[model samples]
Structure formats: structure tokens, C-alpha cells
Target chain A: MRDLLRILSRFWRASLAAELEYRVNFVFSTLNAALGLVLGLFALSLFFQNGHAFDGWSFDASLVVYGLFTTFSGISSVLFVPNLSRVVEHVDKGTMDFVLLKPVDSQLFVSTRNFSPWGLPDIALGLGVIGYAARRLDVDPGHVPAALLAALLSLIILYSLWFALASTSIWFVKVYNATEVLRGLLDAGRLPIAAYPAGYRVFFTYVVPVAFLTSVPADVLRGADATSWLAIEVVVAVLAFGLSRAFWRLSLRSYTSASS
Target chain B: MTFLRRARAFLEVYYAYMLVYRSELLLWALAMSLPFISMGAWIKAADTGAFPLAPVEFGRYFLVVYLVRQLTVVWVVWEFEYDIVQGRLSPRLLQPADPVWHYVGGHVAERAARLPFTVVIVAFFFMLYPEAWFVPSWTETVACLALSLLAWVLRFVLQYAFAMAAFWTEKASSIEGLWQIGFLFLSGVVAPLAVFPEAVREVVLYTPFPYLIDVPVRALLGAPITLRDVLIPGAWLLVALVAQRLAWRAGLARYSSMGA
Candidate 1:
């Protein structure tokens, strides 16, 4: 764990230096992320314009979900997305040989090799929105621990899901589309799960488990019982990660260097 | 070669290219379906007297929004940014044809290929809510189709213009992202413009953003579309064309001056 942390720190330093080479990008990305937050809030306001509550979610609850979605997406963009999406290119070009030859765990190295420091603005904006929403909802401080736990579980599940998809690049060679699928599923997280039709609700809640990503955390913030959902999230995260790791190992055995 | 012949060749090449990337195109189409998330919220609100729309009406509007979205979405900014940054634009610059035409041809061909998928989605939606499906008059259908084509053109030009910012900065996609946030609210992607405050709606109607998605969608849904609605987008199209030409010329000058 310490070695992983040290390697991540080194990677992050390099990423920061690379990003800082373009100062204008810092300004534009910050503005872009801020605009994303504004759009999320604007959408929520539009929904509340028709009613105070949507399905069973109060405005504040929905805002919490929106905030969590932004935060999760920001993290994904910064960490998992940039790294996992590269698996397709690596597999296509036979660059995975180098990744496999690395001294550290291949999955760890592959998943944390790059970071986008610009994505921090989105995370900051998301936390701000979440704090603002919590204030409006008068959320109990007692629930903060549970919400954080759920958030961690959500991240784990999402990472595992992305890992599994990225591993398929070994066979499919075009599995970068998996990132788009992940993105589409995350968009569904913008709304409370209850708002969806029965079939969609089931699909999102169980099949993809996107409902656990944002809505469950937001539900915890809203003082709802999230214990059952948290349990499911933990189980899903473990199963997903184990299966994905096994798949990655199995796929690696089939990989032939492009040069060969 | 004549413009028509050159365009035909480009179309054939890009159609084959798009066929190879059909999964990616389908993934993008799925990613752009954010309207479904909003649809769920609005449908629930409608059931509870929060929204003026009946659940079926919300269903129909969002279903149409989905189709319009698929038809109008543009990724030229990302494509151009990639070309500029990766030095790929240099070879294209030597070609007699404007590289922008390549992008236009690719997008148009992809859309053509995507028609069957769109029809499948529409059919599935209609199956779920047959009562919500409304076929407009033949005249209205013709008008909607024309406006939708215009909308696609405007979106393509606008995004191409935005992508030209790559000549000045590395973060042109950030600008595109910001522009998309504006479109999300102003283009009636999140909700019908009728649901917005009247003053905001009036101002939004005057902007080019609405022409990108809203006007065509409203027209397709058999909603009232005034002469001004048509005229505004027509004027915007002319403006966009001029702007695109200027930006392209200036961007190419900068690119050459930098010896890239």
C-alpha cells in the first residue's frame, strides 16, 4: 500500500507538471467544470419549477444526488477514465507488454498511471453543491459517516466495473466504448432511482447498480435507511473487483505483442 | 474535381470509416440520451401535479427530444482538437479540399448509418407507450425534417468554429464543454422551453442555441413554430458560416506561422 501511494504521488507530480505547462488550460478547464455544475443546478431548478418534489425525492435530495454524481464523475475523469480507456490503445498497439513487465501490480499500475489535475475543479464544485444541499435539507451530522462509506463503496464498484470493461480490450480491441457506456449509466444517476419506470429502475438498480452510486449516498444524507443498499454495494464491489481481476489476468495470457 | 464529386468521395470514405466505428457511434448516441433522466423526473412530477405536462405528454416530448438529440449531436470539436494536437491536421491541410468538409462528411455519413438504430429505439419507445406516439401532418413532418437538417448544419459549424480555438490554446475542448452546458439549458434538452420562465424562454428563443435542438424538436412534435423561429435560425446559419470561414482561415494562418 505504501509503495502504491508512493508511485501514485510520483505519477501525480508528473501529471501536474505536464498540465501546468498549459496555464490557459487551467483557466478553461476550471470554467468548464464550473459550467457543468451550473448546468446541473439549472436542471434541478427546472425540475423543481414544476413541483417541490420529484417522485419521492425532495429538491434538496435530488441536489445531493446531483452533487454526488458530479463528484464521482470528476474523480472518474481524474483517475479511472484516463487510465482505463488507455487499455484499449495499449492492447491495440501491444503496449500492454511494458505494463505487464512493470514491477508493481499491473492493474494498479494501469489504473493510476495518469491523472487530470484539471478535474479537481469539478470535485470542489461538487463538494460545494453537496454542502449547500445538505444545509438546505438540514441533514444530520450523524449521517455523514454513512454517506462517506456509501460514497467509497460506490467508487469501488465503479472502478471495478470500469476495470472489467477495460480488460475486454484484449479480445474486443475496441472496448473503449465501455467508457461511454459508463458515462451513459452515470447520466442515469442524475435522477433519483425511484423516478424511473419499473423496468428501468430494476435495470439501473440491480443490473448496472448505478442507483448505488449517487442515489443511495444521497438517501443516506437525507436520513433514509441505506444499510441494505450499502450491504449490496459492498457485495457488488467485492464480486466485481475479484471477477475483473481474474478476467484481466486471463486476458493478459492471450495478448500477443503487436511486434510479434 | 467538382464540389459534388469530391463530397461524394468523402462521404463514401467516411461511411466506411464510420462502419468500422459503429460501436463507438452507438455508444455516443447512448451517452447523449440525458433526456431520459429528465424524462423520468418530469413524468413523476406530472403524476403529482407539479408539472403541467401529463405523464404521456412528458413521455412523448422526451422521446422526440431523444430523436432530435441523436440527429443534431456534433463531435467536431473533439475531432478537430485531436487533429490539431496530434499533428494529424498537417497532412489534411495539404489536401485541396477543406478539412472541415471531411468532418462534415463523416458526421453526415454516421448519421445516415445511425438511422436504423434510431428507428429501433423509436419503435421500442412506441411499443412501451403507443398512446404517446403522435404522427404529425405531412407538411409538419417535411418542415421538421428541413429544420432538423438546418439544426445539424448549425451545430456542425458552431462546433467547428469552437474547435478552431485549438489554434490559440490547447484546451479548445473545454470551450466546447462550456458551450454544451449552455445548450443543455437553452436548447430545451433538459425540459421543454415552455416550462422555463417566460422571460428566460423569450431570451433563449432569440439565441442560436435553441435552433440547435429546440425549434426542430418542437416542430417535430407539432408544436407552434412562428416565422420568426425559422428566420432566427436562418440568420444564425449565415452568421455561423461566415464565422467558421474566418476562424478556419485565421487558425490555419496561426498553425502555419507556428511551423507546426
Candidate 2:
């Protein structure tokens, strides 16, 4: 664990240095993030224009969900997506051998090898939205712990889901489109799961579990009784992580060293 | 070779290239259907009389938006950004053909390759909501198809122009990202323009954004097609083509001066 921490720190430093070389990226990403938040707010206002509530979600409540979705998007883009996209490139170019030969866990190294510091603006913007929404809703301080716990579990589930998808590149070598599929699912997370039909809600909650990534956390923040949902999220996260790790091992076993 | 023969060869090459990435094309078609996400919320809101659109109308509108989006979406910004940053445009410049056609050809071919998948998805939606499906009059159908082609051309030129910023900065993709936020809301991807606040709708109707997706969708949904609808998009297409030409010339000059 100590070695892994050191490696991650070193990798992060390198990534930060590389990213800082292009300072304009920070400005552009900040602008893009702000524009995205504005659009989200616009969409929310449009939805609430005719009524006070949508499918039992007040405007402020839906904003909370949108905030959670934005935060998740930031986290994924900053950490998971950049790294997983590399997995596809490495597999395609037979550079996976170098990754495996590294003096650390291959999965760990591969998953944490890079980061996009520009994505920080997205995180900041998302937190700002969440704060504004929470204030508007007058969320109770008592709900903070559950909300934090649900948010953590949601992150875990999302990372596991991305890892599983990235691992498929070892066999398919061109499953990069998996991220696009995930993006589509994440777009759905901008609204409460209950807003969808019964069939879509079932598919999102159990099959893809995008509902758990944002809606459950938002529900907890709204002081809703989401304890059971949080429990399910935790269970799903653990199972997904274990299954993905096993799949990674199986994929690695089939990976022939390209250098040879 | 003559221009038509060269164009034919480019189309064939890109068509085969697209076929090789059929899975990615299918995934892209699926991803572009994100209108469904907002459709769910609007439908639910309509059910409670919170929105003006009937639930069935929301279904039909979003379904048409989904299909039109798949048909018209352009990804040239990413491609041009890559070529500029990696100096790949130098080789293409040496060829007899203009590189813009390479991107245009690839996009058109990819859309053709995605036809089967688009049909499958549309059929599935039709199966699920047979009552929501509507076939427009022959004139409306023909006009919608023509408008969609114009929309695609305008989008392609606009994105290619935007991507030319890569010659000046490494963050060109950020411009595309920012444009997408505006396109998402103003183009009626989130909801029909008719449902927007009357003042906002009036303003949006004058912009090029609505011509990109909303006009074609409205026409396909049996809304009255107007001469103004065709004229506005035609004007925008001419503007985009001029901008694209100017940007391309400036970008090539920069590329040459920089010895790249």
C-alpha cells in the first residue's frame, strides 16, 4: 500500500507538470465547465416552468441530482476516463507488455497512470452547483453523513464499471466505444430515476446501476429515506470491483508480450 | 484524377474504414440518442400536467429528434484537432484532394454505415410505442430529408471551422465542448423549441443552432414547414462555408510558417 501510494504520487506529479505546460487548457476547461453548468440549469428551469414539481422532484431536488451527475462526470474525466482510454491504446499498440512489466500491480498502475488536471474546474463547478442547490433546498445537516457515504459508494461503482469496460480491450482490442455507452448512461443520471418509466427505471437501477451513481446520493441529500438504496449501491460496488479485478486477471493471462 | 473520381475513391475507402469500426458506429448511434434521457423527464412531467406537451407527443418528438440527431451529428472537430496537433495534416495537404473532403467523406460514409443500426433502434422504439409513431405527408418527408442533409453540411462546416482553432491553441476540442452545451439546449435536444418560453423560443429561432436539429425534427413531426425555415438554414450554411474557408486558409498559413 505504501509503495502504491508513492507510485500514485509520482504519476500525479508528472501528469500535473505535463498539464501545466499548456496553461491555456485550464482556461478553456473552466469556460467549458461553466457553459455546461449553465446549460444544465437552463434545462432544469425549462422543466419546472409549467409546474412546481416533476415526478415528485422539486426543481431544487432535481438540481441536486444534476449537481451529483456533474461531479461524477468530473471525477470520471479527471481520473478514470483518461486512464481507461490509455488501456485501449496500449492494447492496440501492444504496449501492454510495458505496463505489465512495471514494478507494481498492473491494474493499479494502468488505472492510475495519468490524470487531467483541467478537469478540476468541472469538479469545482459541480461542487458550486451542489452547494447552491443544497442551500436552496435547506438540506439538513443530519443527512450529510448518508449523502457522503452514498457519494463514495457511487464513485466506487462507477470506477468498477469503467475498469470492467477497459478490461474488455484485452480481448476485443477495440471496445473504446464502451465509454460512449457509459456517457449515454451518465446523461440519463442528470434526472431522477423515477422520472423514467417503470421499465427504464428497472434497467437503470439494476442493469446499469446509473441510478445509484447520482439519484441515490441526491435522494439522501434531499433527506429522503434512501438507506436501502445506499445499501444496494455498496453491495453492487463491491461485487463489481471484485468481478472486474478477476476479469482483469483473466485478460492478463491471455495477453502475450508484444516485445517478444 | 478528376474530382468526381477522386471523391468516389475517398468514399469507398472511408466506407470500408467505417465498416471495420462498425461496433463503434453502432455505439455512437446509441450515444447520440441522449435525447431520450430528457424525454423521460418531460413525459413524466406531462403526465402530471406540469408541461404543455402530451406524453405521447413527447415520445414522438424525442424519438424523431433521436433519429435526426444520429443522421446529422458531425465529429470533425476531434479529427481536425488531432490532425493539426500531430502534424498529420501535412501529408494530407500533399495529396491532390482537399483534406476537408476527406473529413466530409468519412462523416458521410460513417452515417451510411450506421444506417442499419439506426433503423434497428427506430424500429425498436416503434414496437414499444406503436401509437406514438407518425408518418408525415410526402412533401414533409422529402423536405425533412433535404433539411437534414443541409443541417449535416452546416454542422460539419461549422465544426471544421471551430477545429481550425487548433492551429492557434491546443484546446480546440474545448471550443467544440462549449458549442455542444449551446447546441444541446438551443437545438431542441432537451425539449422541443415550441415548449420553451415564448421569448426564448423567438430568440432561438433566429439563431443557426435550431436549424441544426430542431427544424428537421419539426418538419418530420408533421409541423408546418415554412420558407423561413429553409431560408435561415441556407443562409447559415453559406456563412459557415465562408468561415470554414477563411479559417482553413489562415490555419494552413500558420502551419507552414511554423515549419510544421
TM-score of chain B of each: 0.93, 0.94
- lDDT comparing candidate 1 with the true structure: 0.82
lDDT value, residue B68 of candidate 2: 85
Candidate 2 lDDT over B136-254, as tens digits, reads 88988887898899888888888888898888888788888888889988898988887788998898888888988889988887778788898887888888788878987888777
Model 2 iRMS (Å) reads 1.6
Worst 10 residues of 1 chain B by lDDT: B251-260
Worst 10 residues of 1 chain A by lDDT: A47-56
Best by DockQ: 2
- Distance from true location, Cα of A29 in model 2, Å: 0.7
True contacts kept of 2: 0.69
| lDDT, candidates in the order shown | 0.82, 0.85
With a 3 Å backbone cut-off (N, CA, C), the pairs that clash in candidate 1 are A50-B50
Off by over 4 Å in 1: B257-260
Error of 1 at A212 (Å): 0.7
